[model samples]
Target: MGRRDIDESDFHSRPTKRGSRPRTKQRPEHSDAVTGLVTGVDRGRYTLLVKDPDDGGGDGASGEKIVTAMKARELTRTRVVVGDRVDVVGDVSGGEGSLARIVRIQERTSTLRRTADDTDPYERIVVANADQLVIVTALAQPEPRTGMIDRCVVAAYDAGMSVLLCLTKADLASPDELRALYEPLGVEVVVTQRAPSDDETDGANSAGQTAGGMILVPESVEEVRERLRGLVSVLVGHSGVGKSTLINALVPAAKRATGVVNDVTGRGRHTSTSAVALALPVAVTEGSPTDTFDGWVIDTPGVRSFGLAHVEVSHLLRAFDDLDEVAQECPRGCTHLADAPDCALDDWIEASPEDERPARAARLTSFRRLLASRTGSDA
Candidate 1:
């Protein structure tokens, strides 16, 4: 689809009463008050959970204010994300359970995105302001597949978001053995069980330091609250990865719906067909501050495919930021490693000063090895 006819200047400020002195004009106050998070989005319509006026914590943003079914036509942008913080107007009460209109959307920090494919130009933003991408995997009825995890890593790295590998249903499999595969990569790998106890050394860092990071919660809602206390995490994986199960477990009545994994194909049917955000049970854990306030788990539709088109070659390089010194050696305007010719970075290492030459060579060698693994070229 082409860009919607949202005039880029629609949100732009016009000539003010104070000429040459530019300032954003406030909207009419009669418009419904309060900001809200886009709880659910579908068919160009969004359901908003507006925060209470006095609740400034931003955390503990209870759904005291509910506005539902805002249309896309009224919105400035055609697309709406599940976790987006938006400005709403009119009938904010959602009227005897009727919907409200989302007048404006606040700026988003980072957008979780993907392209249709290498040939596709349109950028699809999955969820905006997502702090973490939790790639959930299970080890019981459905086996763990690292390919799915790798794709999630690529997406997370592309968005500059941290990635967490969560292995669920650990009792069914040796969770420790499974976690060992990813722990070496320096990525945070969490092992969760159906039964979480203070007795068992709980490794999940429920310490709420930032927003938009992911945590793996077992079948317990208390565990979800404890682990995902104050972050905006998007749980993604193949169908039957226990994502919806985890969401339903986290938020008491989230009602995301769960499907049974096929004993043959080892995949579950799509239960939650679209990305939807729900208020997590913040009051579950009594002692830990993880049960403090506002947090949401964006349970997205299961993925059958994940392509890297939305990511650029620059993304791959930045993932290994420790080796940027070698990156500068590539010829200017050179196609890094794929589908090109004579763009040698080795020449830079060979020409460097004596003392710096060895370090450059080492970094360049390491960079090349990594680059070769990704691009399948020894350039």
Candidate 2:
């Protein structure tokens, strides 16, 4: 075969002018940028609520308007989530077809995060700056999964956010069992039952409310509304739970879709595909005005699994105030599990007063269950 000639010019590296220009460390300040709350994130676009200075103008603007924005090129690696307080630049007028640029993401007070599974290292931030984590669990129909609830509570504790257990479908099953289990952990429990139809006889239950007289609204919907007022809360649960139904009751304008539990699998079908933050009404009463309040409720898609791969044992212990103090005296490198050698939790439980020993022991058992879950032993 004849020898082929190779192009030496192709082998020689050519200097491109792309990086020849000196790059400055300093970037634009964007002082005119206005702060906005990220209401929803879809694809690469973010929906933000920004204050409109000309809100009361004859243009018929409200105090705030919804603006769609994209992340700045400099923030290519940053993840912007719902409930994030961000500074945006560009056409923030929020007018039709107006798009803005999110230049900066402010520091988050709290970040709710999860992994795909217990062994997954990569973490996904569910929401940012949310002060409360509302875990919705059904008492019947689909059946309540304590494992899921425990994991959620641990995540909230790790994130330094308060946890609220919202039990739904009370009419189908009693919440007394679940209430006794979580209330001792200092977690607030709210039992919400569907109102009875007009054909049902009017009778007062344990909570002192006429089921027939009550409208379609859940009896404790007002309690949940008050807890969510003046704060940012994120609702998470399995598919069949009534997270969307509760959100609709809290904010009539939300209109989030609700789904039913699979008859065979006993799991809920996914209705919401992503996280969305909705503003609460100033007064959520039946005939109140249409104005919005300062509070926010972020409804996330149903999660089948909540991974704690990024959570450390130390952080998990901190979530249990009662156990954390006793855990401090344990031997170094203790797992705080039941089989741990010379674990202080076991000793502390035994040392408690006779009247309090049962309660303390129960807390210890609950804490150990959560600790075991992190090791992928049970889920």
Candidate 3:
């Protein structure tokens, strides 16, 4: 679940439409509608994937993953985002594509979006309902930006998702030294260290094999694939952070084009084309049997700058839940910034000479700094 709020009623409500289609072409009513996940969005339509709707109520699920074509006219005004679990009202024949009407869109767990840069013309939704935000950074070449990592972590925290830091190219940089920057923030830091283990080594050599979570990968496609098992992870980083390289490595046949970090400008050339999800299998444990579609990985385009002015200051302070109590002590209408006249608990801080008001003040200052640096109008 995430904190990004959305209008609930609109989940299935389609806007008033004024178009007519051939009634004779409409297929007969299906027995009972089943749910499916929206995996792809294209050409004013959606590609829905549904588990078997027959068998023992949901039996024969082995070959039930069907791709149905859905249009906005039938879905009303509902904008179906990727990962949307929708109920379809039509034949879901897997072999032959059939027209579908998105009758209902199940509530989402979260929605990830970013304000378009000052140069861009519109807001961009990276993906929806992701549980983790992974910031993949490199050690050398383009270099790591603590500022960007901090922003992504803050966004994850504000959006109520786990934050992980993945440092690539450890061969060139000291993982211990570089990882220290985010280790204190409780972020899971994955460094490119250690050789592949027996399982990882074996899996790395095989094209399709079961793997575990967070496996050590050393220039091995299989190792990377196994590590991503059972996760709804979204990768965020600069252009040259090896997001696409890593994706291609894990899914060798993906043939995802890779680009070099601009030597002169210190930026990554865009690859991957568009943001899309790659499903992964989760390692089965205990009584639960393993199956496909256990996890998902979403890759997005590179960014030079990530402005946080679109986010609220209250949301920023909330990132550190441990410190929220102190913020609650603020005076009514407190901006929580330095030297505010309305901080109700000002006397408490002032009485304690050793207290660090500067640090507390700095946290609130981030919003102002974001605004000053923001482009165009965001308010």
Candidate 4:
């Protein structure tokens, strides 16, 4: 038969009536996967906290086990960041040297992002699932930069997180100026100062003292703690704004290093190199035997600038709910900029009663400033 002529079909096996075995294209259910909160990320490894099976003991006491994990091959393109709730598989015992795999990242309630600069198109996720953004600023030393604060506020509004202006170094300068600036935007402000201490005057000898003899337990500390009690807050600020110091105060066990501002340059050295989600100490009343975990505080590296290259003008406008309503009456395709012809925001502000105009104008100005930041244009 070969010598005569071999047709292509002659050399092949006869096809079955049912044809080749059908491939189901089914995926693994990952039924055994456990959920964990990502507390830290370094290199390619993730540090997660998984609740212990017996966490809620009879006394309602809860505990967590820390596990180290790496992203699964299937999630290579997914970015797992601090504060992300992820599904993990493999050995989740959190035993020494035991490794796990992150198979999935739970949907984030909010994501804070910023570009490297105004011109950079790539947006970097600052943190995930944060409910509040605490913009830490110093009243003196490095000096508060309204520009930076404004940019961070815009980022917070864009991410749908509440904004808190945390003013540090109040003893160095009054927070009235910065407070006045952000007050119109309805951002809550908290002013904190390192309580004066005799040991602080001892200078270098006080190195062993915590945070340079800055009293961690004080009224201002308690106030800040109260605000953080039930929210997942992310602290962001420029270098040397006393952010790490404040974190250490709220979470005594955090031990985040503190740095001093350079007398000449007025900039503090960056002590925190990465973002870490630290668990706040359980608040205990003097007579109460039970304690409660306040919430998580995510500490991020200081940023010199917060760019909004990835943010759109419409997103900024939408963040101002009141202004968004007025903007609805704007002419078709109105940019909403100050120069936009027949923009409704201007008419809205002009029509407001004198008592309400100041606030209305301030919000409009802030919204326009954020829009300008995106394009490097004047507000």
> Which runs of model 3 end up more than 4 angstroms from their true locations?
1-31, 54-64, 74-77, 118-123, 193-229, 251-255, 282-293, 337-379
* Each prediction's RMSD to truth: 11.7, 7.0, 12.9, 6.2
Write the residue-wise lDDT of candidate 3 on 1-379 in tens digits. 8787778765974445455443576744444777777767776677776776464332212444656667535456657777677777766665565677677777878766566553454445666788888888888768888667766765676667787777876666787865555555567777653233346322222332212322334444334445466667788889877776665445433445566778899888887666666665343223433344456777777876665545656765666664456668776777544456765344444554466765444433443333233322221
**TM-score of each candidate structure, all chains considered together:** 0.69, 0.87, 0.67, 0.87
Off by over 4 Å in 4: 1-26, 57-61, 199-210, 282-291
lDDT of 3: 0.61
Off by over 4 Å in 1: 1-33, 54-63, 72-77, 175-181, 194-227, 283-294, 330-379
lDDT of 2 by residue, 63-155 (tens): 778899999999999999999999999998878899999999999999999999988989999999999999999998788989889889888
How well does candidate 1 match the true structure in TM-score terms?
0.69
Q: After superposition, how far is residue 160 of candidate 4 from its true place, in Å?
A: 1.1
Query: Candidate 3 deviates by what RMSD?
Result: 12.9
lDDT per residue, candidate 4, 1-379, as tens digits?
A: 4667778867878678599777677757788999899989999999998877867531112577889999998789888999999999999999999999999899999999999887887889999999999999988888788888888988898899999999987877888877767887879999888765555521222211245666533567678888997789999999998888788767655778888889989888998999999876555223433235668899999888898887777887777789888989998999888889999999998899999988889878867776766667777
Of 3 and 4, the candidate ranking higher by TM-score: 4
User: Per-residue CA lDDT of candidate 1, range 1-379, in tens?
Assistant: 8887877677966676776666557555535456878878877677777666655644534335667757435455567788888877666765676666666678988788876554567888889888888888887768887655666676787787877777777667887764655554446776565543343221223321111233334333354455565778888887877776566545544655666789888887887788887666565332544334566678889887666666766776787664455557666876555343544555665668999887666555444443444343554
Error of 4 at 118 (Å): 2.0
